[model samples]
Target: MSDGKEMRRPGGRSARVRAAVHQATLELLEERRWEEISIPLVAERAGVHQATLYRRWGTMPALLDDVVDEWSSTTAALPDTGTLRGDLEVYAAAVAAPLQDSLVPLILRAVVLEIRPGEPRTPSRAFRERERQLQAMLDRARDRGEQVPTLAELLEVVVAPLYFYALFSVPLPAADAGRLVDRLLGLVGQKA
Candidate 1:
């Protein structure tokens, strides 16, 4: 017990380090392409030793995967507006808002590229979360005797277009969310 070394608390220092690394990763992502990011660069930006990055994340892809997962999980909350159309409108706007951030597309691309078959991927986790939210909204509509499109229909009709525009860097106006919801409702034979 005579050693002069300071012992780190279980979560205190660890949590701070992780947060700094994540923030640094996001900042770097905004300024540079995913391919250009490296562990040493991230370590320098995060003010952590390179060994910390290596020990915590192991590799660049793994670090990027963690970053993407963290970012996706913090996205807009699921909207519950009673009506499916109302829910979709709010959800659409929320989803579209993040695409306006330059870092989002890069993170999305990294998620897509780093996804491995049979692994618990960020996209799969995100999809499952969306599925659960959509299911709840659809169930509510059906219970109220309101006709609603299936989850797949909503994904294809509404979510697909929003994501397509985001990935392609297309300008998605705020009004587009309402229009997208209207288009989905119209396609499913529901009055907008």
Candidate 2:
């Protein structure tokens, strides 16, 4: 890479606009369902023009998608701590901290409760990204010679609890994550 100080995005100002709109969306989501929120309301709350929202995102689903993406961004990457225990702790923290965020519950509820018969499976891009990230983590564990199980197993054992507790607004027990990793590794050890 060329001593990277000069690369600039084409729409730096628009980034601020996007953040404003996303925040506005979250604020609106706190008070109303997606059906009740509108572009005009979001624009007013964000102090951005309705035309800007339309020009950038074009529709309600699209705008909601962006907001969800930003919120989900926290789950974008998992740390490659050399041990499975360390990795799972990082994962636990990532999943747990967002449960307290004003927006995570709304996003999770919409995904779990608001699906229509013919719509795409999950509108939350972050959920989809998390699946991919989880897979990578599993593969890393296996590559490191840890006795990891399938992604489904990991999900049921670890990720499921993370999401379940968060979605339900329950605080995770401090030892729960560590205990989960212990169970996971024990299963692997037993298998071998």
Candidate 3:
């Protein structure tokens, strides 16, 4: 006695399956380079049928995109330090800390290079998530009657350099985060 519409349950089988698959993917990523991982390997490690993965993710890039999306969302927590400069410094440091891990750059490269024929290029989920976090911080600054740089300006002046260092496997010292925040605020005619 079932209707045509599919019913979804909260914290049910789908969530459990996704968690298992994501964990397996992360484990594989830690153990090997991105190029060496395959769907069959992930399926076996996750203990889920290969067909389930294929049906859900469609391809390896799609699966990796999902994995990174989840990872970024979980790790990026917005800071409320009562001042935009303080918030930006904390956020920048958080961003730099993860790039110190060896696997992050490899995963980022794979995600950046993934191209689907019919799909128009867009920013990665991690980028969008960062933008969202920045937006919240900017909104708070505005509420406190502080002038803040435009989101694009912040991304270019502050975020780009931090990410560039990570992309090149350069060491990003914690002090650099504070320096970047100072530079961004100074450029926008605000005190750091």
Put down candidate 2 lDDT per residue, 39-148, tens digits, no spaces. Answer: 99999999988987998899877776676666556443688888666787777766566566644566776555434457665444556687888888888878887777
- Runs in model 1 deviating more than 4 A are 1-12, 117-125
Count clashing pairs, candidate 1: 0
User: What lDDT would candidate 3 get against the real structure?
Assistant: 0.78
lDDT of 1: 0.78
Q: What is the lDDT of residue 101 in candidate 2?
A: 63
Better of 1 and 2 by lDDT: 1
> Between 1 and 3, whose TM-score is larger?
1
If scored against the real structure, what TM-score would every candidate get? Answer: 0.79, 0.79, 0.76
Pairs clashing in candidate 1?
none
> Considering every candidate listed, which one attains the maximal TM-score?
1
Give the range of the ten consecutive residues with the poorest summed lDDT in model 2: 1-10
